[model samples]
Target: MAGGFGAIAGLLGRPSREPRLLLVHRLDERDPGDPGDPEDPGAGPPRSLLVTHPRAVPSESRGGHTLALAAPLTRVTNAALAPATNLDQTPLVRASRSMMAGLLSDLDHDGRRFGLGIDDVLLSLLRGIVLEHPDASRTAPPEATTATRLRAFIEARHTDSRLDVAQVARELGISRRQLHRHAPDGGVAAMLAERRLATARDLLAAHRALTVAEVAERSGFGTASRLRAQLARRAGGTPKAIRQAASA
Candidate 1:
């Protein structure tokens, strides 16, 4: 069980903050030995520890390849217990496999390898699950659509100095209220913040010539102070430090 979990974690890129334990034996075979018999169920299922944050996995990438999977507690339990069973028998498992195959196909189409880093693979798996089985109340919720639009908006205006929510709403022909409605969970501001910070980190790692302010602006943060605060809070370092580390 540990080996399986480790393999999946390696594929998905486990985050530093979460505590994850992977059980390795095939579900159809004997017990994996390290069953997570936590004393408390209210604390959350063992799998919950694997994905505590929504952005724990990076959803989009320059490589244009990602896969997502979300299995129901029951399904996950079954899979963990019996690895030899075909996941397709269950709706969640089938959906997850389909999503993974599609992602792999996209990567293959783009002439990229299907192999993804752990974080990306993990994000892809969860995305597939959420997309296929949103909560009944969240049915038709604008999250997926809004995320797509926001991603497009970010990509288009990655270099713009005035890339605020208002402008993004205007460009998308939607009011700020409507955009906010589309992302009620975190709203546009949170999404943009995450996107910009991630982009800034990527740029800092990739380019030495770009200044901190330049990286901030290009990444949609608008200012170095905002970027710095965000980096300190979420990325745990100053932009300069991130760049310096990248260079080193």
Candidate 2:
């Protein structure tokens, strides 16, 4: 199941009550040949920066590197300058820049009031880099294997009520079994159910004007009864209860 544009727009229109950002900076060279750990006075220091929201951390080494910033777009909603290196010397640099540019463009164009869809942008960038980069074999992220494809499929059809395992498999040109194998245990059906529930929950929490049945239909549940049953089973609350709580 997926969210409708109206539901998504409503979620986007809300104020930035919860703003989180994740900044990841990995050393271009994972295997630097210094056996002595610097902190231990025998091996070299590990190079990485995993910073959380609203926090800026400084690094000691000012080496040429690739940086990925994943944050809620509201914090930096305006067009901002990001550093880019020449990819001709380093192929990964070029791939990273291309991926980032596509994301920034999407943010500039389609973002709602609170922020851009950074999660969707990041997912799209990762998928493109993994599938299209020439040297993907050398530096591709490990999680880029199945999760990326699954995410791409979901994002592509996040608004379509008819999206199911069969439809997804047909579009991706893979077998149903292959799609299930790509997903975690309990497989595609379970994943789809979870996504639908999450979308419904977001809408319920944010949109006071929408009815329970409207949210259900918008989030891709076939009928209000089915939505109610699923919400009760998964959330331990009725749709009406959830909506009331949200309003309260």
Candidate 3:
């Protein structure tokens, strides 16, 4: 989230907020992305930012913002901006990228209101990428905590109403202690409930005819009454009200 759009409107839409135009060149992890000796970050011609998403950002480097998103990064050739080149596309890669774009679109980046559900979607994509390129995946360092990984694991299976932390821990090959050590602000249960609620709202907004009962079932709230209870307790509204608000 830049203070203003800057030149990002032509590139990626505020990075944390919108997907970038991969026009002139595609982003690569190897691109030279150092903040330089004194961190002179200004909006320059062809400004490059790096996500290094999910990696632990240093505490001191955050400046004043609670969350800091580095600029976008792109590959270069011969010390010059590289031109776009053709590359092979696969369904796995395409689906991974498409989900990422959708997830980015759904989050409120400028407001810094990134919900756990979005991280759930992101971690799943990361694991999928590991499968896509086992060689490169093995070379990178693993995330220090399993909190985000748990989000992905639970999200991929959240539709199964029976999902519990214990089962998730066992499947992920980690102890429950590790799971809760770096849990999100409200912890796992809260994250799951929020995720389900988000899904329910999306279903309602997209399908005008979908009844509360249907949304509840698909979103894994199991029963309509349970869904209603959670929605009332957490969202302060009924399913119909949420649906209307979303569509509005």
Candidate 4:
């Protein structure tokens, strides 16, 4: 968003029920009226695909033809979609401009909010590039433990009350049994509850003004009674006790 990005449009997803994937192709002079301006006419063209986001306006070096697709992020359960670092390549990037022209037949697929079923395919395309580091893949490929990915997912999404063990397992591309097989001693549910309780206590200590219910909501506990019960069973006797201890 800073210094007028040249063409980094398809690089990241936004916080939305459905991420918008923009397929970009080059345009030529003979094309119809001005396709419209690039997101940053001054910025360079995009390097890799982002989850669900608008296409950056094609740069002067590359003409602009965009195909937009939308699908619920939940529909994509692949661990690769969790994160993708920047992937900048040539030929495949430059000489590859024309390949996108093949998808024109499905242009009608553009702008529709749901039911195209390309979500998995789109995210999977970047799996190798995203999950495996270029420098390390050929030698010692880094395999993230299931526990690591699960913890990262929950850390990012715990505020959503709907989050549960099943959803976390799905996000990690594993079954509930597989998830438990790799879980710590107390198992997945205990891990999640611990995360929530940690957040609740931190909020109580840091923001003395927040109510027990507010702390519960922000910490993913869903209700003050739930927060209190956990605290009573765990370390904190109460939210007030936490704040008082912090002050002391």
Candidate 5:
């Protein structure tokens, strides 16, 4: 994570909270033969445009007031930034940036807090990059930590009620087959339903002011009757009983 927005903004002479218009150019992978000596400059003016999306940052990275790309995106990005000796923009890079812009915009307008949704969009963008540049994808380490990523995404968007495996796959820039491959024990749908139930349970137990209908909608259960049925099936209790117990 970066130190803070202040440091970055200070360099740009802008307010810490405001977006900074920073430029990143002249990127090259570290070469043993090239001592990185400024005097031995071989390349002309740098060609890459590095635009920071102020809304795409994760929670932890947000604490440091810095923007960060997910791990999968990072490797592809590094690969894209490397091997550049000229200002020539590759098709792959252009596509990735355009996808990135759309992802940022979607997450911002989707009325969900930043978390899994953001990661999903990023993963989807990474998937697109891989399609365009298979070699770049292969160069990065294998992503085997789908459990954590999926959990986070579910937790963030379970309230949408429309959240599902196919929607998630679309947002993550992957196919339904790929999504199943990353599914946890019961599968993505099961996991999402479980999360919604869990959230409803908590709301019922603690928030006396929220009616069962309100709890159901906010927790993504959609309706009180549905929330009641699920609660009886999985939680073995009614919303009223849960609230009474919590109050007592």
Candidate 6:
């Protein structure tokens, strides 16, 4: 009986080391140490449970290709492990756990050549789990929708010299105080200035023909001197230097 108990303990104690591959056609398996690197991993095998963030593109680029966007599982793991017996009983959690168990069993039986369908299912499960994670308050801001909308609106109108806190608040259909709630970091004026500066940088980089005054006007700085001052303070160089570097 002592020998039997020792064998049981050993069986239960082994770390799971089964190799797994992602189902995406051209993405390679992840190396955990360098997992967060932005370089494309290329078509190789897949590593299990590696989360990667891909940049958003224009609406035209949404389909007919395989892509994934996720942060590392470690970002939400602690929150997921929080003691929540009541949450565990929820149907969503129960279903996710059941599906995960089935996936694991299949991996053990079929030796890891999972189909794309399996990957899609697994990714959906992970997204659900991350969104419902209890410690999300500490992990990511819960008011992301407002922040996203605010940023998108700002990007669209950063070229308007009249784009101020009042304008932003009007565009977002919220009061200045409500907008402040969305941006707790530096406040509305700072956010607007940052967006305008970013627009100025993009303009300077893309159009070598545009004069400093033109770039300044188009980027909503209204005056070349103001643009120069902003560049000196925030961008660390003259607009001419920025354009020259981009051309080179």
TM-score of each: 0.39, 0.44, 0.46, 0.46, 0.43, 0.41
Please give the range of 10 consecutive residues that has the lowest summed lDDT in model 5: 78-87
Clashes in candidate 1: how many? 24
Q: Write the per-residue lDDT of candidate 3 for residues 1-248, one digit (tens) a residue.
A: 22222232334433453222231112221123444444544322222212233222222222231111222221100011112222224444455444544444556555445544554454454444334533322221365246655665555566557777787678878887877775787777777788888878787777767677877877878889989999898989888887668778
lDDT of 6 by residue, 154-240 (tens): 654666787788978887789989999998588977777787788788878866677889878878889999899988987788988
Error of 1 at 226 (Å): 2.4
Model 2 C-alpha lDDT per residue in residues 1-248, reported as the tens digit of each score: 01222222233345664332333333343434455445554323333322232212343323434345444422222111122111122344344454554555666788733322444456444334333423322333465566656764564454456778898788767898888878888787777777788778887777767777777776777577867888878788887787778788
User: Which candidate ranks first by TM-score, i.e. highest?
Assistant: 4
**Candidate 3 TM-score to native:** 0.46
Write the residue-wise lDDT of candidate 1 on 1-248 in tens digits: 12233344463344443222221112222112434455632322112122322333233211222233333222121111211111212344444445555655676678664432433454445434434432301223344476555555554354455767787788877888888887647777777677778788988888767788877876777788888998998778897798779878
Residue-level lDDT for 73 in candidate 1: 23
TM-score of 2: 0.44
The sequence of per-residue lDDT tens digits that candidate 4 reaches over residues 1-248 is 11123243534443553343332332422223334455644333444433333333324423343332233333222243422223344444333333344444444457433222342344444333334434312221267577766765666567566789898888778999999998889888888888888878888887777788988987889999988998888764988888888999
- Sort by TM-score, top down from the best: 4, 3, 2, 5, 6, 1
Task: Give the distance in Å from residue 248's predicted Cα in candidate 6 to where it truly belongs.
Answer: 3.8
- Kindly give the number of clashing pairs for every candidate: 24, 7, 3, 10, 3, 3
lDDT of each: 0.50, 0.52, 0.50, 0.54, 0.55, 0.53
TM-score of 6: 0.41
Model 6 per-residue lDDT at 124: 62
RMSD, one per candidate, in order: 14.8, 14.5, 13.2, 12.8, 13.0, 17.8
Candidate 3: where are CA atoms >4 Å away? 1-140
lDDT over C-alpha atoms for residue 120 of model 5: 51
